[model samples]
Target: MATHHKADQPTLRSLTKRQWIRIASVVAVVGLVVAGGAATRSIYSHANAAPTAEPTAYSISDAHAASRGNARDALEGEPTYVNVTINGKTRTVLGTNFTDVKSVLDAGDITLESGDTVEPSLKTKVDESTTITISRAGAKMETEESKIPFNTVKKETSSLPKGTEKVETEGQEGILEKTNLVERSGDKIISSNTFASWVKKAPVEKVILVGTAEQQPQTTTDTSNNSSSSNSNANNNAQSASNNVGTTAPVGEMQQWAHDYLLANGGTEADFTATVYIISHESGWSVSATNPGSGAYGLPQALPGSKMASHGADWATNYQTQLKWFWDYCKSRYGSVQGAYSFWQANHWY
Candidate 1:
């Protein structure tokens, strides 16, 4: 029983048309689902992948290089050179980036004291090759006391004996005050000037009085015998009379001449009084008057006696010549006889 039957093959005509369309649609739908699943898996994998960074205009390397360059420039910066003068001395200093005059001085360790001065001003800007000046000033006041000498004046008086002098008033010194302005540089003084001066005390003048009068002659008699006594008496009386007459004559003549001369020469009664006073004290109105100590001569007591020679050759003997010289002397030295008398009153001499 080996029978070989042929297997039946299926054909399109074995299904209805509606059934075939339904089967074809089911197949298309399954294929579309499979393709959509594959596309979705690819998109999900791309979204999950790591991203790459974008390039920038400036990099970290460039920033680091710029920072290093700035540091190098700061180290290589040039220093500012400045000249500074303090008092009278000048010196050079080096500074870096100093803004003002005060900062520049601070860089040099210079200090400013009260009353100190700066040429460019402390707030002024400083630069390379800038010059600055400083000055120091000081002032001090001091008081000093000093003495002023007094002057001595002399006068004549006929009330006392000749060649005698008496101090009428004592001399006194005076005081003065002075104020000065001083300029200095360091320890040296440049200049000093007197600003003010005043007298603290007024001086007192000295007064002195001189004496003038003629001395009387003395008479001596011998008592050895009566006859000798009589003769000595007569001779002594005659000599006394003669001496009295002679002494009076010269004085009267001198007084008359002085009065006439002074009155005729624009002189007043006061001047005549002063002239008589001085002449009486100086020479006792003697034409031949001479100073034993100084060789002074004449009524005016002309020193060296030769000074009167200019007036007259008979200055040693003539009363009128001595009087004329005396007038000239009074005019030249004291301006007037009254002035000479005032001087003589203070100094006991004219």
Candidate 2:
């Protein structure tokens, strides 16, 4: 009843412009914070940290090239600087503007020729430190190895009573060298001849020489009872000299030949040490060197004792005959007795 009296509520109106402005301001601040956060994240991504790498351990100490600084680079478009490797380690360089291969080389003070081939051509873009092999072009003749030729070396021997030459050693030759090779390219050989010398094809034949193969007959007697044995030997030797001119020599005479030849040449006390080896090898100082199987005889291993007779009629027992042959062999075959001795030092049979 009393409620309707004089009091009436005012009609409600819409939000004010100031209130809408305040709400818009809050939304703008939120949006700004979100955008700022995104921008910060992008900056962090662009600022990527570089990874760590190992350091090289190398040193240089010299006058000409050793004094130069160590330089290396991780190249991209162009190599900034040249790289020098030392002691299996790498270093770094900076501040260079080399563009092409030739330019880079030029900066490094390298020169090239027309026929020379570079690993990377001059027109190519330079990226990293590259190697270039410079080979000079020229014509030349050379020697090289080639295949051995087929050969058949036949032999005949009178030593065998069968009267037939037999092969001693069947040998296959091997190539030694190729010489005067013709060049086709710059300094390379296109074709060449095999200037090879064939190996000695002396057959190692088992010869059956026709001679006294049996041991020389000997009679053992008491030294006290043998009064004229030496004289008997002398007479027998003299008789042998008169008849068998090809194969008879006194042992004492052979020794004398060796001694005389050594003295006449350059035999010295030091050489005597070496001579001992020679004397021990060839007939044990016996001038009558004889290989009953091969029919080699005489002081210097003549093919047959008969051949020594060419030296003189007394070639069989004469010291001078043996000395001449031995001296000639030493001088012609070997430069000197000392040279022969050096060979003997290495080869016990020399």
Q: Write the per-residue lDDT of candidate 2 for residues 158-268, one digit (tens) a residue.
A: 223344434444534333222332436656556432211111121121222222223445767666656688668657644543222121111244444454556676665
Off by over 4 Å in 1: 1-251
The model with the greatest lDDT is 1
lDDT to native, each model? 0.56, 0.40
- Candidate 1 lDDT over 1-350, as tens digits, reads 89664567546677778889999999999999999999999999898878432111111111111111121121224445456665554544444577889876765545666676899998898875568887656633344556645545455554446899777668686654444434567888775433223334534546565655556575576535667876875576444432221111113556767767777978665566566656655554545443322224566655434456788877767878877887787778788767777776665555
Give Cα distance to truth, residue 215, candidate 2, Å: 56
Error of 1 at 308 (Å): 0.8
What lDDT is obtained when candidate 2 is compared to the true structure? 0.40
- Candidate 2: the clashing residue pairs are 72-92, 156-165, 157-165, 168-203, 168-204, 168-205, 169-203, 169-204
- What CA RMSD would you report for each candidate? 47.6, 29.8
